[model samples]
Target: MTLYPRPDVALICGVDEVGRGPLIGAVVTAAVILDPTQPIAGLTDSKKLSEKRRVELAEQIKQQALCWALGRAEPHEIDQLNILHATMLAMRRAVAALRIRPEWVLVDGNRTTDFGIPASAVVKGDLLVPEISAASILAKVARDSEMQALHLAHPQFGFDSHKGYPTAAHLAAIAEHGVLVQHRRSFKPVRQVLEQGGL
Candidate 1:
């Protein structure tokens, strides 16, 4: 790991999003400015960690990070703006909601909006950057919790297990129950179901 001298740099928040590929629910993002004095061990991309580990790290991040905030684009927003634009909207909101304004924004993916702040896009940032990793964990855990809640409301969709991804089980559920209000109408699978006259 290389040394990052914070003295010369402006406050920076690492940003990342989850649920872009999901068939239902909102796209969630998080921006985190980690406290340099309170370094967290074992931070990595949320997808690389176990669910239990991600949950543990998420709590630690919330407690120890200098500032953190979550933002989201609801299903209707995704349908209206398309996934890519909706994701950028969520990222912008995450930055705006931060307690401390970041002089620089480091986003996980290779593309992002200006957000009226200086921003740089990093490929695979969630894996290479600690701040991005923390953001990834927070975003993932929050979205997963939302999926669990949706599961409670519609256990037939198996949201708790598949998290609204287009798994065989999930597709079958859509075939049986039809698309729910939360389903992304612009997504191919859901659109196909709707085209077929639905359930």
Candidate 2:
């Protein structure tokens, strides 16, 4: 078994983003300041966890964290600013919302615009850092919950089934039912719908 490394900083906050590739909904980011005094087990990348496990870990992180916060950039913002900048904005907002300021931030990616505090971008950091993993779990579960709620508004697209990813089912629904307001019109499928006069 390989051991994930924890940040060496005294008060480190983990940052991560979700929904960057979704064809709909907001890009959500989460920042978690873990209590080094009380470390949680089973912390790893959110992608490595089952949905049930992610939900469980999200709850555990919330309950056991020193401070945590979530932020998001809406579809319109993503379209206006581009996904990369929008994602970074979401991360910045998440860190800003934290009740306790972190001395250092460990972000799970190759790039970050700014973190307010000293920060380092860890390539595939989510899999290697407990705090980053906690952030990933929070971001994934929150975005999933949002997509599930959107499912209630547009059951025809089966948002619950695909969680806003561009699945064959979702594409078929768009082709058949036309694009809904929740769908990102700037995305490839939605753009195709418009170009093909499906809208």
Candidate 3:
């Protein structure tokens, strides 16, 4: 068996996910490899940046990164596999979708996914690693856009405002309007509502 070499040159990719806490929609992940020659400034955790800055940085990352890809696991999948496993699945998919194979992946958070490619998990890596920050921005922008689109389909949930998070507004909406097909039934809040026979 030919063993993969340790990450060097263009072989290391950064990975991150967004929408893990949302009660609806998919857990979206991104994998990005930045070109050493073209460095992006102001890279940081996606949550720290304003929506405007994240959008701008996301576009810049997409245009300048050596290669990047996104992956996601739908609510049904999250319910079936659990959030942690579904997140791993999405991360693996993102890595696999890369046009060029990476020797290793650096992922944000404390647990690493079994993506075939070797991976190391770093706490707060999204803030410290430029590539990971880029990935975070990409994932956040993609998932936020998805939430906006979802709002168009089901305005009752206020997806565009809360992004399906278990905010008071969303909970109240669910209590008033009942659950949607996109809601994660496995989540405690949604499960409680379902057990109570819905709205």
Candidate 4:
């Protein structure tokens, strides 16, 4: 892990969210506090890594991080609160779930919610901060696993392949198979389909 300069802070937490754009499932967030002594190599943005690498790194992170927690806002919550607010809610929950309170928090985005701690939003932080990258990988792997499970239950929707994103295939599947309970009714494509009585 790349050591960041934090003058008196011993516990620094990194935060990130995944699945915000997906039409189904929850918006997942993760908080990670890395152990300075347990450095994890090859940490970077989850999107920059292959699926195999991400899965491998995710395991390492779970085993090695000082403390880590995941939080999520379900599809119903996403529809009620909107993606932005729901994402913030998830982030807050992630930090709250952490066993160790961090002296400082860094979020991987341009905006951060009130974490009730010293927190800053770093644009593309997952690329620059190892802790944020670790959170990103964990959130992604968790969400993708949810999608894979959803696929097994409803393979017609292709959740495993597209991860519930609003891809053409996913849209077509919704049109043909109707909306699943897992789909977010607030999303444009899903809303359109529902309005057209496609569900």
Candidate 5:
């Protein structure tokens, strides 16, 4: 709680990722440098908030934060580099794209990536840190919007509802309709379907 404006550091960025478990689309990440002067209320892990609230907060964060940037690792990159490494790559890209350079970074989760700056990994940071919470909201909102777009393109997959997760309906869709380029080929369900010549 209250992990910003350290006695020594001024600009601190929060980092978080979304969509690591999804079967389709990219792993998206967000880096946020909150404007401590403009404190945001109702900040928490994105999963804890309603989609409507997350969308509202995402817009507020984008407008109020000192700087923020989004990054993503595509499905092809996820297959080539694996989810863990691809997530780290996405985190790095999010930070690198920031308009304002952060003096220190606080990333949610147990692991931290090399952002060429001082950084620490705060477990459950999205709950404890406002910055990370903002990042989580932004990342989730962005990725969910993508899933909605994918739904428009491939309505049979029900992407709008499942957001490309390995739900029973999604697996059934893959089984019946075959995998789209958006599906991560390395994922077990997709791989199983492909190996069985389901495609």
Candidate 6:
């Protein structure tokens, strides 16, 4: 695919998110404004990068980019606002937190936030845009780190292994240990499990 370059270079920001489908923990979003002249090599979608590579690239993106910021929507907030809305909220927060006000916003997915700036929503944008890819890496790494910390407190759930996503192992652990505060009760899988013998 021929990825489109930013139409305008002045303060162009790219946005992407992580952990939206997780059954536990907060959803994270990142917005990054890159230096059009100095591009970071090996920047790509977070899903395409290894954990080690993602860590390395995130550091590089942070140090090399003009500015970047991460935002999160907690489990309670996700439950209250729903995933789609919460994801947009996180995206908006990320963009707002950036040190520079962006002229154009390129988002990783179809949803556009109310940033009051001109924005474009590109499907699978993280794969196509360098700045979006950088944002994706940052958000993924940050959320993974947070989940690792959660694993220490809730060892029974094995949050580190599944990263709060709804996998068979994570579901089984939830079934055995019962719902913790981190579990999103609003999620159908969690709600179903809770109804089944109070697991």
lDDT of 5 at 142: 97
* Tens digits of lDDT, candidate 3, 1-199: 1212335655789999998998999999999998878988888999999999999999999999999999999999999999999999999999999998988899999999788877888788887778788999999999999999999999878898899899999999988888899999999999999999994
TM-score of each: 0.96, 0.94, 0.94, 0.96, 0.97, 0.95
What ranges in model 5 sit over 4 Å off?
Answer: 1-7
Compared with the true structure, all predictions reach lDDT values of 0.92, 0.88, 0.90, 0.92, 0.94, 0.89
What is the C-alpha local distance difference test score of candidate 4? 0.92
TM-score for predicted model 1 compared with the true structure:
0.96
Q: Each candidate: RMSD to true structure?
A: 1.8, 1.6, 4.5, 1.5, 1.4, 1.5
Top lDDT hit: 5
The digit string of per-residue lDDT tens for model 5 on 1-199 reads 5664342689999999999999999999999999989999999999999999999999999999999999999999999999999999999999999999999999999999899999989888999889899999999999999999999999999999999999999999999999998899999999999999977
Q: What ranges in model 3 sit over 4 Å off?
A: 1-9
| Candidate 4 lDDT, 46-80, residue by residue in tens | 99999999999999999999999999999999999
How far off is residue 133 in model 5, in Å?
0.2
The C-alpha local distance difference test score for the whole of candidate 5 amounts to: 0.94
Worst 10 residues of 4 by lDDT: 1-10
Ranking by lDDT: 5, 4, 1, 3, 6, 2
Better of 1 and 3 by TM-score: 1
Write model 1 residue lDDT over 1-199, tens digit each, in one string: 3323333465878999999999999999999999989999999989999999999999999999999999999999999999999999999999999989888888998887988888778888888878899999999999999999999999988899999999999999999999999999999999999999994
**10 residues in a row with least lDDT, candidate 5:** 1-10
**Candidate 3 residue-wise lDDT at 2:** 21
Q: Given candidate 4, what's the lDDT at residue 151?
A: 93
TM-score of 6: 0.95
